[model samples]
Target chain A: MPKAPAGTLYRGREGMWSWVAHRITGVLVFFFLFAHVLDTALIRVSPTSYDKVIGTYKNPIVNVMEVGLVAAVVYHALNGIRIMLIDFWEKGPRYQKQMLYVELALFVILVVPDAYFSLEHTVRTIFGST
Target chain B: MTATVDGAGRPVIEAPRSRAPRPGRARARSNFELYAWVFMRVSGLALIVLVFGHLFIMNVLDGGVQRINWGFVAGRYASPFWRLWDLTMLLLAELHGTNGLRTVINDYAERPQSRFWLKMMLYTSAFLVVTLGTLVIFTFDPNISG
Candidate 1:
C-alpha cells in the first residue's frame, strides 16, 4: 500500500535523524572530556609529557577539530537546556520546532566566537605570542 | 469520552481495542512512540557505560590529566587498534547524546511549528558536528608547521 521504502515515512524522517544526532554529540563531548581530563593528568607524569600534550593541541588540524568539539558542546548544551525547560517547566511540545530553531541560531552565535578564540590561542601557542 | 446513538438505536463506540485508532493508521500519539521509548532506555544504558568508562580511563587512571601529549596521541593513532577504538567511541557517544536530547525535544515545545523548527535546528547542528568531528578525528595531523 506504501510507495516509499520501509524506513521512509512519518516514522523515519527528519525528526528521527535529529534525535540520533543529539545522542551522538553527547557521547562525543563526553569522550572528548574524558580524553581531555586524562591528557591534562599528564602534568604529573613529566613536564615533557605535559608539553607534548600541549603541543598536540597546537596542530592546525586539531585546532579545527576543537572547533567541532565546541560546536557539539554548544549545540548539545543549548538543546539540552531546552529539554530541561520542557521537563521541569512543562513547556508545550507544540513549540518544539521553534525552540529547536532558536537553539540552533544560538548555537552558531555562540560557537563562532568560541572557536575563533580557541584558534587564535592555538595559533599563538604554536607560533609564539603575537 | 462521548458516544452517539443512531435512530435505529445502535450505540456508536469510540476508542479502539488497542487504545489507538485502527491498524496501520492509528492516530494514537503520533508515530513510533514505542520505538522512541525503547531507544531512550537502550541509549541511556549504553551512555552510562561508555561515558563512565571514558571518564575512568582518562581522569582516574594513569597519571591523571597530566600525561597526555602530542607523541602520545601520535602513538595511539599509529596503531589501527587505537584508531578503531577512537572511531567507535566517536560514533557511539554522539548517537547517545543526540538521542537523549531528542527525548527532551519531544517532551517540551508546546506549539507544533515551534517543535518542528526547534528540532530542525537541532538536527542541522547535530549533523554538522558529527560530520566535522568525524573528519577531524580521521584526518588528524600531528605536525602542521613542520
Candidate 2:
C-alpha cells in the first residue's frame, strides 16, 4: 500500500472547512436555543421577571453577541441549503465547489445588512447618540 | 481461486472483492437513518423561512431588541397567528437542533459510554425545552395581573 496520496477532494479544502463551520455554528445555535427557551419561560413567571431578563439583552455587549448569533444563523441557513442541494440535485456534487462559493456570496449579501441593523442600537448606545 | 504469475514469477492469489447484494437478497433494516436524512432537509427548508422571519421581527424591526419587552411579547402572543408561528418555529428549530447535536455527538464522542450519555443528555434537554416552549406558547396569559 502506498504511504501517502497526492491530494483529496475534502481534506483541508472548502468542503471540509464549511462542514467544520456548520458544526460549530450549529452547536452554538443549539445552546442558545436552550437558554432562550428558559428565558422565554420566565414570561409565565411574571412580566416583571421576563422584562428583567430581557433587559439584559439590551446591553451593548449582548447586542454585539446578538450580531454574532445572527451571523451564525445566517451562515448555517445558507450552507444548509448548499448541503441539501448537494444531496438532492443531480449535478450538485459535480459543482459543489462552485455552490460553496455561491453560498458564501449569498451569506455575505444577507449578513451585512442584518449585522448593520442588529448592531445599530448597540452603536447608538455606545456612542451616546441615543 | 485463480493464481497467476506476476512479472517476478511469483504466484499471485486472486481475491474477489465482495459484490453488492442483489435486490431481493439485500439485508433488511429499518429506514430510521434515511428518514432522519430526509427530515433534516425538509425541516431545514421550513426553518429557513420560520427562523428568518422570527429574527427579522424580533431583532431587526421596530428598534430591534431594545424595544422588546413583556408588553411586546404579550401583544404578539395575543394573536393566534403569532402564537402558532412561534409554536411551529419552536418545535421545528428544537428538533432540528437536537438532531444536529446528536450527529455531532455521534461523530466526536469516541467511546460508546460517552456517546450514549451525551445523547441521553441531549434528548433530555430537548424534551424539556420543547415542552416548556410549547406550554409557554399555548398557556401564555397576556392579561395576568401583577
Best by DockQ: 2
How high is the lDDT of residue A15 in model 1?
A: 48
Q: Scoring model 2 with DockQ, what do you get?
A: 0.44
Per-residue alpha-carbon lDDT of candidate 1 for residues B58-103, written as tens digits (9 for 90 to 100)? 3234532234455665666677776666666556655655555566
- Clash count for candidate 2 is 0
Q: Model 1 clash tally? A: 51
Docking class of 1: incorrect
lDDT of 1 by residue, A1-130 (tens): 3235667344554345556667777767755744654564453355466676676755678767866876775666566556555544655365666777788788888666655555665556578866
What tens digits encode model 2's per-residue C-alpha lDDT throughout A1-130? 1223567446778889999999999999999999999999988889899999999899888888898999999999999999988888999999889999988999898888887888887887678655
What does fnat come to for each candidate?
Answer: 0.08, 0.73
Clashing pairs in 2: none
Error of 2 at B17 (Å): 30
